[model samples]
Target: MIFSSLLFIFRFLPIALAIYYLAPAKLKNLALFLVSIFFYSWGEVRYFPIMLACIVGNYFIAIFLGKNQDKPTVRRWLLVLTLVFNLGMLFFFKYTDFFIININALFGTSIGLLRLTLPLGISFYTFQTMSYTLDVYRGEVEPERNIIDLGAYVVMFPQLIAGPIVLYKDVAAQLKVHKNRYTLSEIDAGIGLFVLGLAKKVLLANSIGALWDDIKVLGYANISTPLAWLGAIAFTLQIYFDFSGYSTMAIGLGKMLGFNFPLNFNLPYISRSITDFWRRWHMTLSGWFREYLYIPLGGNRRGMKRQVLNLFIVWCLTGFWHGANWNFLLWGFYYFVLLTVEKLWLHKPLAKGKIWPHIYALFFIVVGWAIFAVDTGMGDLAMFFSKLFIPQSGISAGYFVRNYGLSLLLGIVCSTPYPGRFYHKLCRQKKEVLRIAFLAVLLLVSIAYLVDSTYNPFIYFRF
Candidate 1:
């Protein structure tokens, strides 16, 4: 269920919050767990058991690792078993089709594709649970004895679907926490954040998505140069607002329940370079790969060649993790090539830490999305790029400019953090009155958008 949905906004959340805060301190975890289970199960009842299995299995694996700290071999074995178990599920559910298609293409034989139903949030929840055992194996954190706490950690509804990818160690303290009371201030802040996120999704992301989806729907054959460019730019905004808006809503909900979830996105489009952009975009995932993957792979400690190889590996995984498509792999490698080149050469030269670098990075990323969004060939992406600069024969170059005037304006505005920042500054300038006015208008407008939207799903929920 989307956070913006009428049922979620008006019914589920309000009832959950009331039950959550009203429960006795000892029962708070149970309340959160039940609500979270219900929240996820509301959409995918079949996946609830899958989620439960993950939670239970990972907890035991972590506990085993914790108990066998002295035996590196035992700990390593436990980690590997759990890793395989988790990744095996993810592979079967998410990547099985992609693998099947590739094998069939290569050998001209149908390997009998497993048309399995992918559980919702399998990508996200699996990663979160895996991190738990991984951290325990790494000696970064001790295991939690309370299964309820661990369950809450895994199923925390806010960031559960797409995440800031909170580490167990980071939130272990909070899960172990209990509060006698939740204050009005906390509720107000949570409500405010949730509403703001709803606005970001409904008003901005959804609006941009309509235009971007239209361009992609046109495919390569019919699109004009300017239209392709507009489509590419529109997609960039769509992803950022969609992902960041969800993160904001999650964070806001966490606040209302007095849980301090980590922040995810940070004005990523404003970043000056590919490296800077990675640091800003989907920060939790970046941090996760860096800490869990890069660091373990010896990071920069092994020097340049290994660093480059490591970068390639991380990007490939990042891409593949997003989807089971070849485009995702290519898109990831594209960034790897760009990032490596930037680190080795461009960091000191053209587009170095300047506005041009941001433009350059965004240029690469948007084109990457062109590759990502289209379920076609590289030639198709190439055609779109060709059209982007050299106009097609029939359609005028101004097709995008003419057709999506308002959406274009909204895309440009929502692309950066400036709107949120400017609003904050304005609020600080006038404090109460302006803040209330802003909130009221945004709340009503977001509600209107939600009411009208048939396209309301938190994009990351299927992650």
Candidate 2:
């Protein structure tokens, strides 16, 4: 049940929204919780118990932490226990096989892999629950006494699987509000944004992604340098549109439901530095690490050396958080190195430059995507890198250009801020009829594409 699917769009969403709107004000959260659990169970029913355990366990732990705030020693121990519970579940499901394979390679032990299925959104919900518990311990927010309201927050379907990673504090007030939580204007905006995102995912990302799929079928060793670069750029665009489009839809749906989810991507492709890019990309995740991990490790308060160490640890975990793959680790460290250099040296120079900074940032960003997308193992990654660097004349990119030129162009343009600016300008000019008409066309086109095409793939669902 991806959002792009006809079944979800026509069946589940319409029915769910109807049920939600018809519920009484005080029971809205209960309705939301029930519908959300059904949504999750529809996709991953086998892991329904695990999700329940997570919600129940974290709910009680947070309640306990809120109760024991006066005792520092007890609160600290409780926080530690909650961390172990959350992170332990994440590691056991996500990384157990990776550790086993590594140990087998090193010490010749044939430990059979458990190969447990990762519960969908465990990575995201774990962070959300942990943030709640941690904030309760810090006295930043009160513990949610009502388990149904807390469950509603944890399993909110829109951002549950692939998130902007909503925090508890961010929505605490909204969850408790009983009246006038939403407006007709907000619903109108949400519909427009959702249609825009649907167009982005169904039309642009899927079409551009086909070129990369073609290149993968041809194999890296057989591709020319031009085609390799094209494939990299295509993947870069595909991932951006896929994940950011999903995030946009999530945020839009949040608005429709009277919640304001935080922004995830902010024209990250336009960033001139790795540091700036992180600030824009998966922003909630970065903020999480910065607040919960980096600051606790002293951040920049202690000294340059300590700050560097803090960055290193955060990046390593950040990379691993994406997956159990070694390439992800390298991809993370790759940014760490770039960000370190930029922070210590290149920051001022990049700021001063105009065109070259964009070029440099995009060049490395594309290369980084190449690294991230090559998941077959180190051999394929090395061969792909060679194809990128060591030029070869084989299959030309001209054929792909002929096939995907318009989509590539649209993706490139949309990755910047021009389209967004145009939309805002329309709003500013009081062009309500024009805006609604345009969104209607986009929505119809996206629905047609969804009905006709079978290539819709969401990149972030695995995480």
**Candidate 1 Cα outliers beyond 4 Å, as residue runs:** 180-182, 350-353, 376-379, 397-399, 426-430
Residue-level error in angstroms, candidate 2, position 86: 0.3
Pairs with steric clashes in candidate 2: none
Off by over 4 Å in 2: none
Model 2 residue 185 lDDT score: 86
Q: State which candidate has the highest lDDT.
A: 2
- In angstroms, how far off is 131's CA in candidate 2? 0.8
Candidate lDDT (C-alpha), each: 0.82, 0.91
| Tens-digit per-residue lDDT, 1-463, candidate 1 | 8787888889998899889978999899899999999999987898788899999999888888888988989877897899899999899899988888988999998788887887888898898899888877877888878899899888988877788788888878777778643577777778788888888888888887888777666666787666777777887788778888899898888888877777788888777777878888888888888988988998988989999999999999998888877777888898899889988988876553556777787787777777777656767766876876686764543756666678768767767677778777865676867777888999998888778779677666655
Q: Report the alpha-carbon TM-score of model 1 versus the true structure.
A: 0.95
Q: What lDDT would candidate 1 get against the real structure?
A: 0.82
User: 362-429, model 2: which lDDT tens digit per residue?
Assistant: 99999999999998899999999999999888889999999999999999999989999999888789
Model number with the top TM-score: 2
**Least accurate stretch of 10 residues (summed lDDT) in model 2?**
454-463
